[model samples]
Target: MHFCELGDPGELSPSQILIRTEFSGITNGTERHAMLGEFNWNHFPGRHGYQHVGIIEATGNEVEGFNTGERVFYGAYVGHRAWHIVDTENGPPLLITLPDGMDHPYCALFGVAGVGLRCVRRVRVRPAQKVWVVGQGLIGGFAAQAARAYGAHVTVTDIDENRLSLARSCGTHRVLDACDERVFEQLKEGGPYNIVIDGSGYKDLFFDIQEHALLARRGVIGALAVRGETTFDWSMLHQRELSVEVSCHFAVEDLTILRHFVREHIIHIKPVVSHRVSIDEAPDIYTILRDRPAELLGVIF
Candidate 1:
């Protein structure tokens, strides 16, 4: 994608506010997929981000409950730049007031936290039950923590040892090497898991989970990562009568719930963030991510 300076959108309308971005979180899932032409709705030079924390620089006369210099957490499809115009009258709610003493960088992770919350909820995990997460990227890692918070025994797997290590530090009960062919056999020793989550965004791995992992009778399979087509044994699926559930983006209420998770310290924000860069370095960083996926996790811009 081409990057260059552009004139800022001048002056806010009556219900608008001008935001000076302090930090924006890079999403390895949607943004990476979009940049690679895998996301159908995004085109080349397409706007790229949905996670940012900023200060309200200017507010129109009609705007209420927001003041200049107020720190706010906002999300939109186009928030990677230094400045953004938020018209409250248009589109989904874009601004959320940052709680006192909340770290801006951590606020940028709210979206990811929400994804984890949603995915775990979809799986309908129960207390004391085993939950297997097949991927240890940011989302997967967070999903494992969320499951643990829900009182489930969480195990995470990934090909990247670094990511798996991060998951271990985040309190996952077990971390497995996804590349190992015996991974599923090992996982089954804990008994068939109540839920098996696919957060690796790897279609082949998802297929492998379907083929090898033994889920609890009528267990749930939650797809928390990006979706793609892959073939697996339909007969196996039929015989097991497994339930597959797919998750989408977070909703407004999900954000509210995530805020509570943060307050209660159920979601660990610090370990998930792995890199930091100025907005100007974003282009190069994206290139690195494209070439080497394991080199980074949560990146702040």
Candidate 2:
């Protein structure tokens, strides 16, 4: 059952506004975790839990900075179908309207891209800083490219050979097998990096990397993980003075930065589509995503 449909959309009270989703892009990080119920229940029952890149089709008189037919990137819950009426008393602030040249599918992938871009922003990579990115899916690719645009030397690591090859073709300097038994040794050989970006959706992986991260000493460790409850060891970070930053959402400024980067060809924003399925096929695709999910970015409806 789609958790988003657990509520009524037609009942926006006198104080609420409504939004319509032209197309909702599923984020690999948060979507995967939520599908498994691996999230803090404290944040539930809010207007948003998933990241939806949608547009406002209608609104209450109280709503400002929005109008019908203006394409925008907004967030909402799981039931962001073709048309949705929401009570937008508290929603993510509208990021921006789609530029003239950018298309809808590209807009669909923007949420995932923004998450990665925010990761780079959090670590504060300087020009020419050496960076290492783990995971070579859409977010990983975007993070690696974003760091490079920030003037960092980037090396991308992933277990999938095809993804690694794609990252290499996309100008990644070094590619390492993250699944190898000597993965830490391989990373150490290239270590003393200024930053390490983790785009893997699993929180368990983050816990495992504590020793090898070297994050405390001379590098920044950034994550786009969908974490629930976990333990953090701050004492270990005291020695290396590493900065640990977790990025959740993209601010409006981040959207502007992404837009400028995409327009300037610095971000290389592209739809990482594996298949195109119709809205009618969404149920099957959801099952696919729920069962044998691969390194897929999304199935656009």
Candidate 3:
């Protein structure tokens, strides 16, 4: 990847805003996919990043509800730079204004948190339902918290012991290491889960859940991961009439609901930001995430 200087943004349109980056978030999963040529637009020297929080440097004459110097968070297809010219009319307003005392680093989690929230909502989890989130990365972690916040009995699983420990401390009902030989037995002790969310982005883990995990009759299995080709257990699903859904991305409405949750303190995001680094260290950060995932989590740039 290479960086080149660009001309200064000038002559904003009637409904445009110029933003100066304050803090940006690196989406480890998707960004990694971009870097490794797995993403659809995997061309080299490409821009990659979605989560960002910045101060408004200037606004066009037609801009409303936003003023210069105000802080806001945005999700753009490419937003790893120091400045951006955002047009309001060309797209729906996905920009969210930040409260005065909000933490900038936490704002970076908005995109992933919104995705998690959507996954939890898609399954229509009810209070007292057993919910299992099979991963503790940013998306899985947030999904688990959302389930618990909505009054479900939430369990979290991860192959990494540290991540599982962190999830337990962060208020998950139970935490399990998926690699344990007795993981299925442990899960059975609490009875079958009503909703099983796969956020590990590992296709093999999803198949394992289909083969080993128990689901109540007509129970839903949510796939919150980037999917790949895999062999599924047809007989088991047909016998149970189970519902399998794949949840990805987010809608504008999801962000609105997440903003309310943030305002009410229903989902505290401070703990999810496990690392912070400058944007200039992008290369080194990518290396760390690729080689040693356990050493990092949410990284704010």
Candidate 4:
């Protein structure tokens, strides 16, 4: 990925706010997908990313509740940049003030974490239910936490031991090594999960779940990862009466709830952050993201 010299954000309108970005988070999965042209909607010379934590540099006369100099987390369909002009009154974008003394760098992943929160909410996770998350990337890590916060008995699996360890530290009830030969047997012992959240974006894993009969009757499958297509045996889903749920980008309501969770320390962001680099190093980071994703998580600039 290459950075372009976008000209300065011009003067704001009466209902606008100018934010000077302090940190912006890289969305590893989505950005990598875009770079690889995995999505049909991707185009040449496009911008990607929606996470930004910045300080309000100035505000228009009609802007209320938000004042100049306040630190905030704002998300829009914009690229990683130094400045953002937000129209609060007619918004496709939204911003929220940061909590007192919240760590600025960690807040860069707020949008990523919000996606996890939205997925759990969309799948309707309930207290005391068993939920299995099949990945330990940033989104999966946060998904495990969100499920636990919703009172589910959460189990997370990943081939990466580091990620599994992080899941344990995040208070997951169980962590399984997907690389283990007997992993499926182990999963069967924990059988008939109430919900299975696919954060791995692996079609084979989804097929395996069905072939192994891992889900209970009427179990919900939450597909939070980006994938081109998912093809599986129809009989398996038909027999179990299973339902597949998909969630895209998060809503402002999801972010509001996520902020509360982050403030209360219910969802840990710092542990998931494996890299922190300056904006100048972004191109190099994107190289690593495309070539060796296993080496990174929660990268901020």
Candidate 5:
């Protein structure tokens, strides 16, 4: 990844605000896909970040409910930078004044957490339901916590022990090492999951779920991970009458609910944070992300 100067943002408009960024979270999966040009929408030499936390340095005269010096989370689509000029009336509809005592670093992860929340809500997770989350990366970990907050019995699996430990810390009912030889047996013990979420970005897991009969009849499958393509047996799906649900970017309401959960300590973000570096260190971090992704999580700039 390369950084280039885009010059000044120019003068702020009547409905705009100037922000000095404090922290920005990496949307690991999506950004990696973009970097590799895996997605059809990806273009060369493009900016790619959505999670941003910054202080409002200046606000337009017409701006209401937001003022200078307030730390807020802004989902800037223009990508990560040192400064941002947000048009309140016509900008991305993801600007919010963070609650008092919210950690700026953790707040930077709201974008990814909100995606997890949206996935859980879209699958209609309910109290006492059994939910299995594949993978314990940032999105998977957050999804497990969100499911638990909704009163579901959440089981999370991952090849990374550290991530599994993080999931356990976040209140997942069960954490399994996906590499274990008895993994399938262990999953069967918690079998017939009401909802299964794919946060691993591994298409093969979908077929594994079917082969092992891990999901209950009519159970919902949430494809929350980014992937190039997915292939599954049509006959198996028809026989079980299962439903497949998919969610992309989160909505504002998802962020609102996620903030409440984080404030209540029901959803944990700090535990998954593995790095906090300055903007200058971004290139090194991205190299690790490309070469050794398992070494990183919850990175903030």
Candidate 6:
């Protein structure tokens, strides 16, 4: 934390974009995972950094679809304040032209929502298929809702009863306490599940259930939780024919579809939001995210 009376606008070159940030949303999963000293982006494309809506102060020589004073979205995990300069490489795969009816906060949730969309898309959910979502913070909540949009009968599981309440309100069939004794009984009778999405940031379930895992036939697992260390038994997934995947950030092409969804209101990604703050307040807010994370889906500034 440095004390400064003022700061300078950042700099960038071609295929680059410079934005005066108006607002950004905190990705609780990734941000919290990063804070726990358990972050693991070691060999991947690294992390999402951060993305939010801002005014275009400058555009790189090679950039297009953006102009001075234009509002657009871009991401960088560490983030930039006052003014941020990012090469088009860091910008959205494509620029977003905010419609007149939308709010910047809703725009900020786009990146996160895109990931959820991708997860649901991959599920290829069959109409009336039973789906289980294992968390409901931001990612899990979005996944649960998206599954519903895909016409699946969805259920959400979370340790927090309050978050469970939100999931129920968000259209889940039922909430399960994975930490309780009654959890197994709640498993739909006659079978385990056609699909199971694990948004929890832990691998303990995989380890513990490997013994009696035959319960879920043709099961699938999605690890969207942003925790540090998670374990999996590859052979189990192979034996059970469970399709396992991880949900990441949105791809460049997905923006148009998401924009359309947001525009048409066919999908709802707004409920997870629980806080709003400013850039100057981000550092302190980061601590609040680490110590007490529950129902606090987004921190916008």
TM-score of each: 0.89, 0.79, 0.92, 0.96, 0.95, 0.81
Clashing pairs in 5: none
Q: Which candidate number would show the highest TM-score if scored against the true structure?
A: 4
Candidate 6 stretches greater than 4 Å from native: 1-14, 40-49, 60-62, 89-95, 207-216, 227-235
Q: On a 0 to 100 scale, what is the lDDT of residue 53 in model 1? A: 87
Candidate order (TM-score): 4, 5, 3, 1, 6, 2
Indicate the residue-level lDDT of 292 in model 2: 69
lDDT for each residue of candidate 6 in 10-49, tens digit (9 for 90 to 100): 4566778777778777777766665565654433322334
Instruction: Please give, for residues 54-169, the per-residue lDDT of candidate 1 as tens digits.
Output: 88899888787788988877766774788888886764565677777656677788777778878888778779988988888878888898899889998888888888888888
- Per-residue CA lDDT of model 4 for 76-169, tens digit only, reads 8688988999987865457888967777789999998999999999999999999999999988999999999999999888999999999999
lDDT of 2 by residue, 204-229 (tens): 55455566664426567786655456
RMSD of 4: 1.4
| Local accuracy by lDDT, each model | 0.79, 0.68, 0.82, 0.89, 0.87, 0.68
Q: How does residue 62 of candidate 4 score in lDDT?
A: 89
Runs in model 2 lying further than 4 Å from the true structure: 2-19, 42-67, 84-92, 180-186, 201-217, 227-236
Tens-digit lDDT track of model 5 for 172-264: 889999999999999999988999998988869878989999999999999999876689888768999998999887877888898889888
Residue-level lDDT for 66 in candidate 6: 73
Locate the minimum summed-lDDT window of 10 residues in model 3.
Answer: 204-213
RMSD of each: 2.4, 4.1, 1.9, 1.4, 1.6, 3.9
**Lowest lDDT block of 10, candidate 4:** 88-97
